[model samples]
Target: MIKVAGMLLLLDFQLLPPTASSEAAKLDSLFFFLVALCGTVATLIIIFILYFVVKYRRRTPDQLALSGRSYRTLELAWTLIPFAIFLFIFYWGAKLYFNLMTPPEDAIEINMVGRQWMWKVQHPEGQREINTLHVPLGRPVKLAIASQDVIHSFFVPAFRIHLDVVPGRYRTIWFKATETGTFHLFCSQYCGTQHSGMKGDVVVMEPEEYARWLNSGSEGSAASEGQKLFRQLSCNTCHTGDSTARAPFLGGLYGKQVNLQGGDTLLADDNYIRQSIVDPEARIVAGYKPIMPTFKGQVDEEQIMLLISFIRSLKEGREQIPPVSDPAGPQPSPVGDAIRQSETNANAGNQPRTNANSTDQE
Candidate 1:
């Protein structure tokens, strides 16, 4: 029992999981507020119901009751009061939702791929985890999650985060840990027969401890692997910076604004790049022809993310972090250099618009 201002409250462990993330405390306050509000309203309603049952009961067999007694002021008060409460809830929930959904600009991005029975996590530093996720304490970590099989929900009660890992697109969620500990990870959606077994642990550790752990078994960097895969898949053949190169140069193209065939312009984000690789024909560059074949069957979700990472490393000013091995870094190309130096106008005649060519496409 806990004693507050003249009141005693019972708190049991069953109320919620351990609050581990920064969002959890705020969410708990909101949850308890809602529960108290509803509980109070219900208690008052029950008291009123009981009082009316006795006071308005039939005392005599021939008793005549009052009819057509309209409480206009009472009606307005009740309706307006509940309306105001709902409005406050909506505003509070919306503000929190907005804050939670928008990941911080500097948050660490981790890629997650969900399958039938397990989760695949890849850190930017190239460490891979099967079902467990390791994050640094007090740092904002954003998860770029996708499903390879069916719909699944990435739920962590301690973190107050629950997001659907849907197929066909990436769903992102961000959380900053407040306490360093292991929390339960679950797929809250009913996916298949072994849905209950789709569980994991989220391990939060000190920043230095996490760095040591990450570097312990580091796979060569994700960008390096992606670069290797890019060559193995013959992507370098067309996406070169040579003067005679057919396709548009890929250097400094990650966050550039691109013009599509229908004059539609959008940032070259992960989804845009993913669509360009998988569909090829969905969104074409304004000045280029669609000749690149679809890589839908050639690459999986993880590979797509790797490719994105590789491309992201090509940002002109930002030197590549978590260095890519083998080639030392992304090589400079005449066309890519020209594209990088020039302005972002489609008709600039110097800016490389599409990663396309006369006969070969990609």
Candidate 2:
């Protein structure tokens, strides 16, 4: 009895990490309720076993034991009670999971790439970091996570969030921190030799501080970098806004339903965009020829993410390419340079040459 009392008392202390997100509180509440219910059932079972053992002890050798006994009320009560408890737990857990999976529309977006031993994090506003992530305390933050080498999980014990980052695909997880503080971030999956070292810190700050930090960085925003890549790779040549172009216009493609070749429709989300870039032939849009070359080996994971960011930034009834402050910042590709040179030479050849006689006449 003393041990049981002690165990119940220990429950007062937090068995999990500190709750730092809104969902964490809900998760903890459900967890403790289940724990208490299980504990009560266990205690009663032990007590009944002990009581029967003592009461049924044989005092005389000739004492006869009862063959069987049945209590319909007790049997029904036990069965219905546990069944009801299980149903309640399932409902509570499912509600919490649904809330966790849905993100607010105004949530801040961030990109994360998990590699063998480190995390590469990027903000849509251009700030990039290795392993560390910073966000505002009260705003919802969505992380578009992908794995470069193998499977990795993004886990924060305080937030009670764990999501798998799979290679060749993008997965998103979102959380809003309720307090301003630093929390631990870990890759829960056993990735490789340095999986233990794949750890970082998630710093939740005031809104003002987060803004200042974002402005302090000099790196171009992810969308801008992606814009540069789009031009360098000559994507605009094919996916032009002109209706006669061989490829479909990408303007306002994100979040829209696209008809595929097989008479199926797919939402043009992040994963779909990534797959379209890396695996062009996988799903060809209806009325468009499958002429796009796959970028599987040509571009890395980070480049793919930049392209995705640029694509998502597009809006309906707007130019496909947003105006960049520094349009010529990125150097032209070798092929582009060669084509320009050829054009320049051809124009020079077409110009009338001033021979000696022509110069005298002039």
| TM-score for all models, in order of appearance | 0.82, 0.81
User: How do the residues 100-202 of candidate 1 rate in per-residue lDDT, one tens digit apiece?
Assistant: 8998766777899998989899876567898899998898889999899899999988899999998999899999998899989999998999999999999
Which residue pairs in model 1 clash with each other? 291-361, 292-361, 292-362
Per-residue lDDT over 275-345 for candidate 2, one digit per residue giving the tens place of the 0 to 100 score: 99989999999999999999888888888888887776554433444234345543211111111123222
TM-score, structure 2 vs. true: 0.81
Per-model tally of clashing residue pairs:
3, 0
lDDT of 1 at 213: 77
What's model 1's TM-score?
Answer: 0.82
Q: Where is model 2 more than 4 Å wrong at Cα?
A: 1-15, 55-68, 317-362
